[model samples]
Target: MSATPDATSAAPDGGFTTVIGPRRSLLAIDLAELWRYRDLVLLLTRRDIVTVYAQTVLGPLWVVLQPLITTFTFALVFGKAAGLAPPGMPGPLFYMSGLVPWFFFSSQVTKTSRTLTGGAHVMTKVYFPRLVMPISTTLSNGFTFLVQLAALAVMVAGYVLAGGLAWSPGPQLLGLPLLVLLMGALGLGTGILISAATTKYRDLSFLVGFGVQLLMYASPVILPLSRLQKFPTLLRVFELNPMTAVIEAFRAMLFGGAVPWGGLTYSAAVTAVMLLVGVMTFNKVERSFADIV
Candidate 1:
């Protein structure tokens, strides 16, 4: 009865035709699409975890060793030399409370920032949600974070049992998850932005490692936000860095009795904005990455 052909019919050009259909937004992170590529994501993650430490004598111990060494160095320099409060907290505890998470955040940011360049092979040859590449990088680094966390916990418990540190849970304890999410999101967003840039400017990958080290100093990693507050103008500038609030939130949740809701709120807002910008920029550039990279 109808002159119109079937929607699935081939066109005159000998190609399958796409009929008028409901439009789907391309910018969205389609979880189902990611799920379809779940096997690839898992495989990549496994590969990263296995190969990352390969040929190294210490292997997984490097995870513990890295933070342990940094904690001691910071404790001796910043904690002691600067007359900062190691407080009732032992030196290792004080330093590790900041070190482990900071390492996780920085490592994730650095690795994911090079995701595009590093995965050029998979990108050109495969059809999957591009995000799966970076997500796998993030997930792979999670084991390193877990090991550092376990090491920190053991040290903390030993310090408490030895009467070298005070042990008291606080209302701020509830904000620990929020702090972790805030840091991780900040890393993910920053990494995504840098990754997209690196596809076009390969130098960006090298810059990211040094850039992260500079960011650690800019943050309250080795000091406190309160210390910076002594210089009101300086504190204003420092606050603009998202990690200022994030690291401060870490201290509040660990040592203080309550969360700094204001700081946490600011961190959440900044991370959200960064994530949106990163995703939009990444989507815009991704179409060109295969050709360029």
Candidate 2:
């Protein structure tokens, strides 16, 4: 790949240009800079999708099948045995509704967490908005989320026809776009925060998986917020998780439950703070990341 100049600086003989440099403000993240690199973002997004399943036997079909398998495992382990599945809904449907969004969010966190480290070779060699890597990762994950959701839709239709579930659409369904953006922002924020940390502390990379699992439990992924009411303190803590609203709102919209406006509103504010902090931290650290990583 050729070096992409971020901006022009000054002239010595033929005008010198710096390919990669920090922005003027530590908190400054230029959205227009990202937009200017739209072609690179698309290229990276396509590469990530192709590279993920390049040598796999199942290929993209894994996107559909993997979630189905995981949903069954969750339905059995959490739904049947533990009896945490919500009342009056198909167990798989309940679990699938939560897992679909959770999968997308988790991928953004996991993959984007590696932006500085995983792509050390590329980062050291060339220059583009470092933000592009995580953005592409988030976009790449959109494909998987859509494929899995389509599979879940088929399942929901089956259950509806079999008299196991009912279709009661709610106005909250119109908020799907906002819900996805919130999920992506939260995930991308959490991810890059960890990525910045891992630059100096490589051990953080090893613990990303464990941290995400703990976070999953903190959210209302396997268990509904309603189920936590008995423990008011615990319920309060869980409600504080930004993902709690993302997953619960999604399950509520998809499965005819009531949307949690109170929790969702709180989560939106939390996401704004987190995303702002993440961008600031990334900008501050990335100027020296190539030297460290």
> Root-mean-square deviation of each candidate, in angstroms?
5.3, 3.4
RMSD of 2: 3.4
Q: Considering every candidate listed, which one attains the maximal TM-score?
A: 2
TM-score of 1: 0.87
Give lDDT for model 1.
0.78
Best by lDDT: 2
Tens-place lDDT per residue, model 1, 101-215, is 8887898789888878888897899766789988888788777788888898899788878877687868877877767777888888899999988888888877999989988
Clashing pairs in model 2, backbone N/Cα/C closer than 3 A: none
Residues forming the 10-long window of minimal summed lDDT in candidate 2: 1-10
Candidate 2: stretches off by over 4 Å:
1-23
What's the lDDT for candidate 2? 0.84
lDDT of 2 by residue, 6-114 (tens): 4344333344543344336877676876888999999999999999999899999988887789888998898889878777777788878888898898888898999
